[model samples]
Target: MNNRKEKTFSEVWGEFITSQTAKGVADITIRNYHQVLHNISKYLDIEMTLDNLSKSKFDEMIVEMRKVGIAHNSIATYVRVVRTFLHWCKAENIIFIELPNIIERETVKETYTDEELELLLRRPEADCSFCEYRNWVIVNFLLNSGCRAATVRNIQNRDVSLADSQVIFRHTKNGKIQVIPLCSRMVNVLRGYMAVRGGVAEDYLFCDQYGGMLSHNALRLAIGRYNKSRGVAKTGIHLFRHTFARKYLVDCGGNAFTLQKLLGHSTLTMTKRYCAIFDADIAKNYDNVSPLAQLYHPKEKIKKQSRAS
Candidate 1:
């Protein structure tokens, strides 16, 4: 064990970031990794040699984080990122120890209500400024497509096709091109927005006041102000995504398989969360779908089952 080359955690982390950058990982992802590193750094000494790494040490770090009031979900996120980093270290012959999973209690993700959606979707006045019009169109787009704000920000004018009834999403979370069909309402909304947005195909679909790409902070603040103006207290941009998923599964009677494709999830893991969220929908349709219920019709029972067991 002493023969193995010794490297500080920070040194290995620097190498990991460089490697991830070379692999074409998204800027947002790299930033997220940095955030996780910052979080763990507060608990563990990054300058220490990785020779001290062990499951027990990490378990203590997790407890330390919790004692300081870090959220369960946030800690889980930190652990996940750390696990990936440690896995890379293992491959590099730095350390080899199995990590334990954190129990992440699933909380139903909050989404916009019907009332909130109605207020948000209300057509802006004719005299509204370009940003006003654009923000309105973006809300419509987010609800219809359930895309990440980053995806929306990166959408170019050429990605939309009124004739084709679809929009090409080039900059998605999974870094895959997604072709999502546009609803008639969203299509019409985009048509008017594009007319006002007027730029070449290369121009970003959603731009700032100066007709350049909207930064992450710009998009977030814009949506926040837009929601507040519409009297929506829930201003999270991603809530629109949760809202879309819920409405699709429950109101539209959509299936999980198709939702997976539409949401661009590489696996059913994330998509299944939406399914689990709307488990009531499954119960409501249980009789219609259950094979046993379909095969056997209870002859009108002469009398109901007794109250006694």
Candidate 2:
């Protein structure tokens, strides 16, 4: 009698997702994994098995995704998800195939310039109402603190200490508690907003007109509307982050290590990329700092006189 264990592709995927959930993966991450898997299934439309999963088939799926005009970064994300899943399966002895290590990705980092930020910060009308005040403060907080939208959404009154000139991030992307020092401008804005907020310590710092906590989407949409009205292009919450990273590096002459800490990055790889993006600025600064540029140059007449003598 033949005795062998076999599982369908869907079964293996379910098990993998279950394992990820058990490991305390973020809900958004798990959802993204499920979405990528679903897309793969829809494209392949084949009965997947441990023995039948092949690199050729995966490559074909990638080609199909490209033909449909999927963004390069998105395709890379799909490839990464699939590669991780296949590695997990291999560890579980469900499949044995060489996983693709590299996926073509385009680095399309976007950031707001100082002029753009000035325009955006002034976009909100000069109204002292709760909503207007909150919106202005939100834009300032995002630009000054460089915190993620999720972090901003999760901020509570207790997390902020105006006297200390800092805010505590209870839930960060890396799952680490971080305390970011607030700039004087940001502190002033927070104090003004708090005077109007009038909420308990446990209540969220930012709220809607109805005094309810704001969602991430609410913050995004608010910014989007303001951007559209102001005629700003490529507007989003993450642009604040990119702008912060770039400004931190350029303004403060910060290195990757310090940037990694401030940005709460697990490694310097991404931070280094930010440095690369600002290479032109770095070069211009280098030109000013070079000894040749700093030293006084002799005139051509002096050189000619000295040679004649």
| TM-score against native, each model | 0.87, 0.82
169-219: candidate 1 lDDT, tens digit per residue: 999877889999999998888888889889999999899989999999899
Clashing pairs in 1: none
Error of 1 at 297 (Å): 13
User: How much lDDT does candidate 2 score?
Assistant: 0.76
Each model's total of backbone clashes: 0, 0
Residue 3 alpha-carbon offset, candidate 1, angstroms: 11
* CA lDDT, every model vs. true structure: 0.86, 0.76
Q: Residue 98's C-alpha lDDT in candidate 1?
A: 83
Q: Write the per-residue lDDT of candidate 2 for residues 79-163, one digit (tens) a residue.
A: 8888888888778776766757655553646789887887778735555567666767887888777778878888999999999
